[model samples]
Target: MIVISDLRIAILGLGYVGLPLGLALSRHFRVFGYDSNPIRLRELRQNVDSTSETSSYTLEHSKITFLEDIKDAQDCNVFIVTVPTPIDSNNIPDLSALCAACRDIGSVLSSGDIVVFESTVYPGVTENICGPELESSSGLQCGSGFFLGYSPERINPGDRSHTVETVCKVVAGQTKGVTELLERIYGTALSAGVHVAPNIRTAEAAKVIENAQRDVNIAFINEVAMIFKNMDIDTGDVLAAARTKWNFLDFEPGLVGGHCIGVDPYYLAFGAQQAGHEPDVILAGRRINDAVASFVVDQIANMLRPSSRILVLGLTFKENVSDLRNSKVAELVTLLTQKGFQVSIHDPRAARLQAKAFYGIDLAEDLDESYSFDAVIGAVGHKEYRALDSSKLLRMVKNDGVIADLKGIWRAYDFPPPIRYWRL
Candidate 1:
C-alpha cells in the first residue's frame, strides 16, 4: 500500500463537486484538476468560477493547477472522479460519463494507485459497474494492480454552511489499507473529519438513501400542499401551527427540482427493480413531486385574471445559483404560457443565453425597468429577490393581483388585505 503522504492526487471532472474538493486537497498535496472542457479549464486558470461555488480568492490561494488534457493527471497515484451521474430520458442511470472517465484514468493506472468516485449512484455501482471498466481499460487486475474507493459528495450548491471541508465525509474503499489512506488524506484538509465505511457498496448505498429520504419527506409536504389548496387552507399556516409540537420535521413544499433530490431516487428505484423488488413509496413520492410543476400552473390559472401578464422570478433550480439542471421552474412557465397568459422570467444569476437555449424562454435583463404585470410568482428564494422590498413587488402587480410565493419569501401579514396571496 502507498502511504497517504507520498501519493500525488488528481481530481477529474472539475465542476461544483470536483472543483471544491480539488481546491481543498491542493492545500495539502500536489494536486491536478482535470476537465475535458477547455473553456472550463481556461476559466479556472483565470481564477474565475462561473459555478460560484469557489471564489477567485479561494481558487488563487489554493495551489491547484487546472489541466485540459488527461496526460496532466498521469503521474498522480490517487485519482478522484467527481463527474455528474445524470439519468437518461427514460430516467435510467447513465454511466456514460463514469465509463469515459474510467477509461481515461485507467489508461494511466499504475500499481498502488487508488481511484475514488464521489458521484451519487446505486449500491454496487462502484464495484460491479465501474471497477470492471477500470480493469478492462487498463488491462490490470482489480485489488492488485489498481483499487477503487467511494466517498459520496455532500455538496449543496449555493449553501454556505455545509461545504466540502465542514460537512462530515463518508469514505470507503475496496481494501482496509485503501480506506485508511483515503481517510488520512481527506483528514488533512477536512476540519469536520470523516467516517470510514466497511466497503465501497455501503458508502454508495448510504449516499443514495440520503437523497431518497429527503425526496419522500418533500413529497409528503407537496401532497399536503395540494390537499390544503383544495380545502382553502394555507399550508404554511398549518405547518407553522404544527411546528409548535416537539418533534416536527419542517420540510416545505415547492418544486423538487435539482440534480440530487429529483434524480437520485430513480437510481435507487432502478436498482430495486433490477433486483426483482418493487419500490412503492419511492416511486409514488417521485410521481407526486414530478407533477408539481403543472399543479403550480393550474393554481396560477385559477387565480389570475383574463389575459394576465405574469412575471416569474428566479429561474435556477435553487436559490442564488445559476445551475438550471432539472429545474421545475421552466415547466411552470411553459404550462402558464400554454394557458394564454403572457409570462416573463427574471433571474439575477441565470445566464440569459443559456436559459434561452435550454428552455427557449427569454429571461428579462432588467426587472425594475420592465413593465408591470397582473401577477407575480416568487418561484425561487434567491437572496437578491429576498432583499427586494415587498411594497415594490406588490406595486408591480395590478389591483387585486395574485402573488404566488412558492418559497414563502414574503410575510402574509405584511401584504395588503385586498391582494390575493398564495404560498406553497
Candidate 2:
C-alpha cells in the first residue's frame, strides 16, 4: 500500500539464506537484518560470518543494520522471514520456527504493512497457518489490514554460481497489487528475473516440488548405483557412457544430504498423505537416500576386518561448504564408530566446535601423518581433498588398504596395485 520508493525492508533469521539476501537487498533499500541468536549477531557485528555464505568484504561493506531484538525492525514496512523449516523425528513438517517468526513480526505489525516468507514449507502454510498467527498477534485482519506474500527462497548454500543476483525469484501474493509490489521490490537485487505465480498455494507447491524432484532423480541414480555395485560394475564409468546422450539427466549417485534436497520431499509427502493420497514415489526416494549411510558402512565394514583404522575425508553434507546440518558423512562416521571401528575424520572447511556440539564428534586438529589407516573414505568432494594426487592418497593407506571414494572423486586415476580402490 506504500510507495516502492519508500521501501523499508527487514530480513528475519540471518543465517545462510538471510545473510546473503539481506546484503543483496541492502543494495537497493534500507535493509534491517534481525536474528534471535546472540552469537550470530555478535559475529555479524564483528563482520564475521560463521555460515561462510557471505564474504568478510561483503559483510563489512554492506549498509544493512543487523539487529538482535525483533522490535528494532518496527520502523520497516516490509518484513521477509527466511527462517529454517526443518522436519521432526517422524519426518513431519515442523513449523515451529516459521510460527515463531510470524509471532515476532506480528508484534511490530502496523496497518498497511506487508510480510513475505522465503522459508520452504508445504502449500497453504502462509494462508492457513502464518496468516492467522499474524492476525491473532497483531489484532488485525490479514487482507484488510496487512498483506501476505510468499517468495520461497532458492538459496543453494555454498553455491557461488547461482547467487541472489543470478537466480530467478518466484513471488506470489494475495492480490495482483501485492504481487506487482513484490516484483518491483525483489527485482532490485535480481538481474535474472522474477516469476509471478498464479496464487500463493501454487507458488508454495512449485517451491516444494523443486527440491522433491531433485531428491527423486538422485534416488533413482542411487538405486541404479546400488544395482551396478552388486554386479561389480563402476557406476561412474556407467554414468560416463550413459551421459553421452543429450536427453540423459545429469544426476549423480551419492549420499543425498543437505538441508533442501534431503528434507523437502518429506514436506511434500506429508501433504499428500494428509489429503488421502499415497505418496509412494516420494517416500521411496526418501527411503533410499536415508538408507545410503548404513549401506555404505556395510560395504566398507565387509571389506575390512574388525577394528580397522578408517579415515573419512570431508564431513560436511556437500563440497566446499562448512555447514554440518544434516551431514550424511557424520552419520556414516557414527554408524562405523558404533561397530567398534576406529574412525577419524578430516575436513578443513568444517567448524570444529560446531561439529562437536552438533554431532558429538571432535574433529582431529590435524591428520595423523605418522599413522596410516586401513581404509580412507572420500566422503565429500572438497577441493583440498579433490586436488590431492594419487601418490598422496596411497600414502594414507597401508599396503592393500582400501580407498573408498563415495563421491567418485578419484575414479579416473588408478592407485597402486597394492591399494584396493573402490568408488561408489
lDDT by candidate, in order shown: 0.90, 0.91
In candidate 1, how many Å is residue 297 off?
0.5
- Give one digit per residue, the lDDT tens place, for model 1 in 1-424: 8876687898999998999999889888889999878889999999999898988998888899877788777789999999889999999999899999999999888887899999999998999989999999889888999999999999788988989999999999889889988899888888999999988988999999999999999999999999999998999889999999999998999998889999999999998998899999999999999999999888889987777999999999999899988889998998898899999999999988889888998999888765468889999999987887877887778768888899988854377867788887
Clashes of each: 0, 0
Ten consecutive residues with minimal summed lDDT in candidate 2?
362-371
lDDT of 2 by residue, 1-424 (tens): 8798888999999998898889999998999999888988999999999988887888899999987888988888999999999999999999999999999999999998999999998888999999999999999899989999999888787888988778999999898889999999888788889999999998999999999999999999999988998999888989899999999998988888888999999999988887788899999999999999998999989889899999999999999999999999989999999999998888999999988998998887786462489999999999998898888888889989999999988987888777888888
Off by over 4 Å in 1: none
Candidate 2, TM-score vs. the true structure? Answer: 0.98
TM-score of 1: 0.98
Clashes of 2: 0
Best by lDDT: 2
Clashing pairs in 1: none
The local lDDT score (0 to 100) that residue 168 gets in candidate 2 is 96
